[model samples]
Target: MDIKGTGAIVTGGASGLGGATAALLAGRGAKVTIFDLNADLGNQLAKEIGGHFIKLDVTDADAVEAALQEAEGLHGKARILVNCAGIGPPAKVIGRDGKATPLADFTKVIAINLIGSFNVLSKFAARIHDAGTIGGEEGGVIINTASVAAYDGQIGQAAYAASKGGIVGMTLPIARELARYGIRVATIAPGLFLTPLLMSLPQEAQDSLGRQAPFPSRLGRPEEFARMVAAIIDNPMLNGETIRLDGAIRLAPK
Candidate 1:
């Protein structure tokens, strides 16, 4: 879909993949509204991009609903939604101490990553379900963020992988169900990237991770991920699929 003048919402848009996406969308002339917990960064980026920002927790249904309403008030009903609000704190099912990991750790990951994405998309879909098509095109597009770990999870990533796997699992069925509403759903499973979490590590550690990607031999750029998002939005046939944005990297079992 042509992004020009269309309304778009990007969750977790303060930094990292979602941040790049919000900038790209706004640069393409889309009226962007960013939903994130980082108010300072979110507000700064929104102002820089000529967009809007709302402090939101994607897992909260009521807050999400209110944020969506506020965003629509600022920029018309959003026609594009990119779900990038997620977390990936690795933890072993069985820790070094030998006791089982706390169940809350697992549930928290699922709640923020899997259930959170679903909450935003479902609500976005409902809002646009009956809306008029944009420029005679489909109703809207939803691009979700997944991870390669969903497929090849290493040790200490059970909760994180499960959450992303759930996202990958639901893509097709949700796409099929939303088809009648002229909405498309797809997920992108990214490999190692230079996100804030990764950047916090030592430079040498970051370089080691970058070398893991076979071809590129470097970490994936946030803007590159943003570009893939744009490509998916531009193409109508790309639905109900999970595209791996990892540069041919099959993660090792660390």
Candidate 2:
């Protein structure tokens, strides 16, 4: 759909990939609302982009519902929803101490990464499904963030992988279900992007990770991911598929 003048909601838009997306969408003339936990960053970005910012946990159903309503009150019904609220703390099933990992750790990742995404998308879709068509054919588009780890999970990535795997697993089915409403659903499985988490590491470490990708031979940039989001929104035929923005890299098991 044409992004101009449309209302768009992006979860985890305080920083990193979501931040770039919120900025890009706003630049494209969409009235954007950033949903994230970091009030400082979210508010700053929102002001910079001339958008709105709502601070809340993505897993909180009531908060999410309320945030959606507030966004609607500000920008009308959102026609674009991007699920970028997720975490990827690495942990093994069995630790070096020869003890099983805490189950809570695993569940926490699933809660925020998998279930959290579902929460936002479902509410966003409900708000827009009955809305009038955009570009004469589509009501809205939902883009979710997955990771290459879902497919090439390394050691100590069990929780992260499982959470992202759930996202990839759900994309097509949700797309099919939302299709009747003219809402398109898709996922992006990014390989190794230079997000805040990775940027905290030393430059050498970041460079090492960058080399993991073959062609570009460097870490993926957040704006590149944002551009992919724009491409998906621009193309009506692209739906229900998970695009790997990995630069042809199949991650090593590590």
TM-score of each: 0.99, 0.98
lDDT of model 2 at position 204 = 99
Poorest lDDT segment (10 consecutive residues) of candidate 1: 130-139
Q: Work out candidate 2's RMSD over C-alphas.
A: 0.8
Report the lDDT tens digits of candidate 1 across residue range 1-254.
Answer: 88998899999999999999999999999999999999999999999999999999999999999999998998889999999999988899889999999999999999999999999999999999999777776999999999999999999999999999999999999999999888999999999989999889999999999999988999999999999999999999999999999999998999
Regions more than 4 Å wrong, model 1: none
Report the Cα RMSD per candidate.
Answer: 0.7, 0.8
CA error at residue 231 for candidate 2, angstroms: 0.2
